[model samples]
Target: MKHIRNFCIIAHIDHGKSTLADRLLEYTNTITQREAQEQLLDNMDLERERGITIKSHAIQMNYKYNGEDYVLNLIDTPGHVDFSYEVSRSIAACEGALLIVDASQGIQAQTISNLYLALEHDLTIIPILNKMDLPGAMPEEVKDQIIDLIGCERDEIIPASGKTGMGVYDILAAIIERVAAPVGDPQAPLQALIFDSVFNPFRGIIAYFKVVNGEIRKNDKVKFVATAKEYFADEVGILKLQPSPRDVVKTGDVGYIISGIKEAREVKVGDTITHTARPCSEAIQGFEEVKPMVFAGIYPVDTEDFEELREAMHKLQLNDASIVFEPESSAALGFGFRCGFLGMLHMEIIQERLEREFDMTVITTVPNVSYKAYTTKGDEIIVNNPSELPDPSKLDFVEEPYIKANIITKSEYVGPVMSLCIQKRGVIVNQHYLTSDRVELVFEMPMGEIVFDFYDKLKTISKGYASFDYHQIGYKQSDLVKMDIMLNGEQVDALSSLIHRSNAYEFGKKICEKLRELIPRQQFDIAIQASIGAKIIARENVRALRKDVTAKCYGGDISRKRKLLEKQKKGKKRMRQVGNVEIPQSAFMAVLKLD
Candidate 1:
């Protein structure tokens, strides 16, 4: 206990956290030179391809310094804002954090967000200036800014390059000297915090935890405080490269306990685990279940694959508790599941995993935020899909969720960014200058406005130099209406969307034009119309394919040609009156991409 350190690395996306972890592993000789790979901690293929960390991973390392053996437990956390909940839990399980900042890019929005989270957890922070090998590295300026913002001592900041393994050994020594060890009594009753869990086909649920008080050994009966389910610890081990069996995990150490529970949901993250015979008096606090914010419907392209998709989702949810889903049927897309996710990125990753890992072809509907609707009878309900919204005649008002958005960018791109925000119905909250060349602008905007393509547009407008972060503030009242799309006077429920009344005309026109481009022409002319309630806001006509009816009348009387043309005109008019348009899947997705 005297020479043990439990800490994690926190940084913004692409800030070299994974590289720093790799270098630390190399310094401690945890893995051989030939066996080491890039982003070793990022096990998911999706994470590696995207160059981001989505899950939190923990590893143990042993180092000798000053003739004393020290045990160092390093937990690597995701850098994206969508995974902030996971970051929080990881921070809670540690005693210190290494806040890495890019020497070239300086501080970003996620960097500030993560710094505040670490502060909230009341952990020791060691600020490290990383990526010093780059040509644009400016360590001194970053050091000054870190001191100014975080208010730490100037000399405490370490300048290192993760790519070249420079100053990494010094960082390891700092962890031993500066970071404090865990404070817990080995004799006290058993109490551990389960920060993460994974599902193994043969081993059942494996819980990764930190021993807070007392010790846990193999064959010990442990009880989950939240679920009240008891299971004997089949095995106890530490993850040093891989799980190595241990006789006992004493206080102040990080290890895994293999409980015989078959389902991952049984062992919730942040739950308290204690010996069933000598259980603690109370459960641990700050153990809240993860709730998803974004909702969408995902269906199999082949209706027969619905069961396979269901089983795949079930297996995936065992590892990812953030995802919630239930059976749903769509008139246009057949049977599916309405799934909830933490954010857009979370939603996309799950979709990709289902496609690649499960080998299923899926069609995803447009994502939506939850809305509050009040009916005329004074009954209030939450609507997750626009088609579920009650008719305008029966509704009193609707409220949409809003977020407080933070954008940090160079001063040269401020004008264009501000214009784009305003177009998205963003209300400026405040603005301040971070430095001579950088600016921070804050805004309060509807979550729906930014959920579609706001981030991509922001990166484009700022030339990929801006960083954006946002959090839910609350709900706001707005003059909102549901606009429906009609093909030849028939309503299409899947194409319905809720929009602000002020932009109804332009939004309707955009959808109509996009539909016209996507919908294939038929034998009869098609009238594409967008309407709010009974009022049509925009319309476009897709002309029919024409076939020369008189082409067969060669060297015939003029009357014969006229008769044929007359008959063709009457047939077209009848077809227009009773034609049923078949909208392809492409058209449904095309409308979702409308600006």
Candidate 2:
């Protein structure tokens, strides 16, 4: 058995964890410079574009140091709190963690959140201060800050910039010296936690796991604990987190096994994968069911392409297991899926992918928070759609999901960021300086505020230095009520929402503008009114279309007119056909536009 060193890179978003992982891979010569794609661990294009790690990626590399060949298994983890459970699951598979902190931004709320999770897991933390070469760099100050946070000696800090490759070798050396090897008997029972799974049509389902105990080779029969099924490994191979796949891996190794299993849902995350002969005695904890907080309905602009939408979602789920979907039917929107996601970015990514990847126009409903409400009959109603909310008198109690947001920024921009937070009904919970010049502020804010452009406003106010993160604390009671938008005396299901008392007017006006821009000029004047129960707070109108069915086609345009009618007919299929006007799928999507 080789000496195992497994550690996860934990940090806040945009803190260079993925970059650090890339440098480490390059440091060990596991991946050539040509293969050193930026954001090496972010396998998704969306992840690379956003400069965030959305999923956990793992790779193994060998480094010869001090006359010994040390094998390192590095797990790259998502830093966002929406995926905190994923971080924990990823951390569960390792014995140590390399906590990456940006030198300029100091430690953020997400950093603290992840750091606490690692400590609770009893994982050895090798702190690495990243982005040291950036302007306004303060490695020394943040190094002390990291030491104070981890309660370790000052020398425990690894000062390095993942971008520059400086001190990367030293960071690797520290991992070997400080982090403990994987603990389990190689000769005992074979059991491991499936941290990740991927699909290859020919290979079926390939499960990647850390072999904590025992050993399994080719033809070893294994059972998925969650699915209660057994299968023999058709193939087993070690992964290097590069484009090339290696042949074999044993104890203390991160690799994958193909068991000829085809079902993707059966191979679930956090499931115990064990050898059938000698099963694991202890089941791993921390496999909490992940719940997506934000909900949106996704539909094809062309109704006949509904089948195409379903296929696109299936392909997307193969790579991203976090997205949840269920069939939804609407009188106006035809058939769609009520999709659930981690947050706003997640929702936007999905919508963008459907449009870009599937080559189909998609309409998405406004993001929403799932809440538990009660009707006057005392029946419990789980309100996922704002349209589902009862009238003010019918509602017994209403609450919203509260998020504990932590913001890290320079000292100069704290006041403006706090002002924005306060405007969004955010209550300042605590504040502390990460360093003498860098500050970390914690606040209790509604997820609704964050569902908007809070991150953008934070960075704008703080001059791009402020980093923000949020985690669901719990649901809190509030005087918030739904303000439904009605067009022509009929509620536009997509344009209804629950808003706080103070900012209801502003939110209503924003939605009104979106509707006016989206709902094309109608044949008859269409009134877009935003209201609170019986009170119309905001109103706008879609003026009648000046002309429609205009014959712009030439004499040979008979076929051209047919094509136009076919396209318009396809578009009209998604319309509600309320009376004389046709509202396109774009109108439903207007509710989702933050701009």
Candidate 3:
């Protein structure tokens, strides 16, 4: 048998994890010069459009190094924080990980977060300082930071330009030497965690797995270790790691099988596809289900396409397990789906995908952070829809989620950035000066505040010198209230919130204005009121339709207006069916958009 190196490439968003994978494929002659492309591992159109890795994609490559054929199982992972759970599962399938860092940018907050997760998994760590060909390439600086943070030996930091293919072979040699061989057996009951899988129109369900203790072959009756369900695999093959797809994987390696199982939901990443002769017991101990931290209501722009919108949601959710949905009926957007995600980036990625992949125009509510509230009855509150908040008097206690954030930046902006965090209800937990001009600050802040524009605000305040990482910490008791939006004297259940007393006005103003913008011009004047317990704080008017859209039908014009109104009524039917208007997700933007 030839040598095997099983590993996953990990880095922060845009740190060039996929770029390096492309270079590795080219260096191994796995792909022809013409076939090798930019960011080869990013297979999804949405991933290509957004310039971020959303799903973990795995492929195999046949490479010859030191006169030995090596099977390189390359797993490319999602870099954004929202998909960290998926990334962690991807990392578990591997025996080693390539810690790709930006040479000029040095180590970032996400770099640290992902690296620590890799270490905790006990995966052999190989640090590859990528982008050495950039304008301000500082290999040594990045190397030092890797050592300080990751604590890998100095030589393990392979400085390479994944873009220019510089030091490609050196990194390959390091891969062969540094990454440990898989200790999984090909003889025990077939036990492997399904890292990721996708559907093929021609081949049916392609189930990918990392065989831990047994063997699988064509025609073998296989059962999921978790489900203990058996199926027949018509075809078995390994995916040649390339820009395109090929088949044929093997024992003690990463690959996929064309099983007769047609249901895509049956084969999930954390599910184990095993040999029926001797099925393994559990999948993996920490196969976490990722709940989306951000949420938006998705509806079609042209009301007539409501069914198309739900169909699009189903399609998007097929590949993205993180997206959660429920039947949401709003005043503006009728019969649409309320979708949730890990964070803002994750939400944008889904929205962009819905439009690009499905070829549909969408009216999306802005993304919002999930909140938990408490009522005066001492009952624990699970508040996802802002429409659920009770009257202020009915609520005695409420709190927003908090996060432990780590910010790494140049020392010059440390003081300013620190002040900004404090202003956002952040308490400084710790601080460390990494270098003479660089510092790392850890803060415990309300996730509510950090979930907003603070990311952009930090970049602006620090002049692009700062990087940040945050994950959920426990929730804390916060002095907050439920602000509600009443359209034409009727409370729009979906347009309420639990907000800090000090920050409530800003949210009230922003959301009230958003409703005004979304309510659309009407036939009669509409009152848009934002209030707290019947005390109106702000109001706006969406004037009635002065024309009643009654232009002469020069050429089906009257038919068009009637058709539009009929369609609008049909769309309005999705709304409460009582008011002159509906609260489509757009109106939910106040709840979704900022935080």
Candidate 4:
């Protein structure tokens, strides 16, 4: 156990964490030259194509130092803010974190936020200046930023390049020397912390955990403390590139267990696993529950697939525990689930994964943040969907969730970035310089304002130099209204959104215009109106496809043409009454891109 080191790599997006992990794997011989690849831990194809790590991956490696073999369990964590929940779970299972900072970029928003998370867990932090091979690398300047941020000594910060495998050996040595090994009694009752789990069609669920106390062996009758379910350990093993079965996984080790628990909900992440006969006294207190910042309704394209969709979500939840959902039905979209996501990116990734992994075709409604609505009857209700909001007459007020947004960018782009935040109804909280060239801007913004296009707009305005991170900061009372889109006098609940009263009109106007372009022209005119209760703010119409009955009578008398036109007009009116418009899948997505 003394030679065992468990640590995870933490950094902002594209800071070379996975690249560094690859080099570490090579030095430790975790994977051979034939199997080497970029982002080897990011198993999802979506992750590789997008050049981002969507989930935290754990793998065990063996390294020889001072002529002694050492066991190193490295968890490669996602750098995006949307996946911070994954980072927290990874942190809970490790004793140390490798804080990688891009030398040219210095310290960004996520770098600071993830550092705070690691510090809160009291994990040993090893600061590494990555991308040293780049021409713009500034080791000394970034070292100063690192020192000011973490208050570590100058020499303690290692300068390394993930591309060239520089300083890989030094990082390995630091982990053995600085990181504290797991310290728990092997003879005590088994207390293993399940940090992550996945579903396998053939073998059931595989739970990855760290043995904090005692040992778990193959064929042992184990019990999950949270669920209080007992099952025989069908397989017990350490996680390498693949699952390597073993007779036993002892204390201070990270490994996986397969217990033939077919149901995805049976094995919960953060639950403790112990022997059924000699269970631990208490369950491990893992990280706090995930707080989803965005809510959206996801319905199957075909209504009959609702059951299959639910099953897929359960299996997905086993892998990504951050997602929270409840059964919901929409008038327009039919039976579906209201899923809470960390952010837009998280929502997109989940939707894509459902399509690719589960082969579930789904229609996602407009994404909105959760709100607290206080009714005149003195009842406080949590409204995740605009359709759930109380009637305006009975509603006293609505409070929207707010976030403390931290944005780090080059000093020159501060003006544009500040203006962008202000346009999003954001209040300036503070602004400070991290270095001579880098500035950090803090703002208090309503979560609803940024749900649509704030991230994209910020990236565009800053030319992709700014890094943004935010956390929920409770709720604040705001003058808000529920804007509903009505197609021919019928409200589509899926397109309804709660918006600030000040921006509601313009936003509604934009949506109306966008739907006008996206909705195809029907035989009868389609009336697309954006309304707040009885008051319609904006309206657009998709013109009917004219048959031109007059075109057939080229030389007919004026009275004869008028008679034909009148008959056609009455026929159109009758069709409008019975013809229900079909909204294209793109129209639902179009609401999200009305910039």
Candidate 1 per-residue lDDT over residues 491-518, each given as its tens digit: 8866777888998899899989988988
What's the lDDT of the predicted structure labeled candidate 2? Answer: 0.78
Sorted on lDDT, best first, the list reads 4, 1, 2, 3
Better of 2 and 4 by lDDT: 4
Question: Candidate 3 vs candidate 4: which has greater TM-score?
Answer: 4
| Winning model by lDDT | 4
lDDT of 2 by residue, 1-595 (tens): 5477888889987888888888888889998877778887787777777777777887888899899988888888998666666688778888899888899989776787788788888999888878888998898889877876888888778789877789998998899888898877778778777887777768787888888777768787888887889999777877775433444456777778888877666777777778787788866653556667667778787789998888778766755667889887665668888887866667777777777666878878776667777777888787777767777787888778899998888788889989999988899999999888789999998887676556656756876567676789988878777888788778766657777878788878888888787776754567888888899999987876443453787688477777887776555444435555456666665566555
lDDT scores of the candidates, listed in order: 0.86, 0.78, 0.73, 0.92
Query: Top TM-score: which candidate number?
Result: 4
lDDT for 162 (candidate 1) = 91
Worst 10 residues of 4 by lDDT: 456-465
What candidate 2 gets wrong by more than 4 Å, as runs, is 241-248, 300-318, 324-328, 354-361, 369-383, 388-482, 486-491, 498-506, 517-526, 532-535, 542-595
- TM agreement with the true structure for every prediction: 0.82, 0.77, 0.77, 0.86
Clashing pairs in 4: none
Preferred candidate (lDDT higher): 2 or 3: 2
State model 3's lDDT.
0.73
Error of 1 at 104 (Å): 1.4
Error of 3 at 171 (Å): 1.7
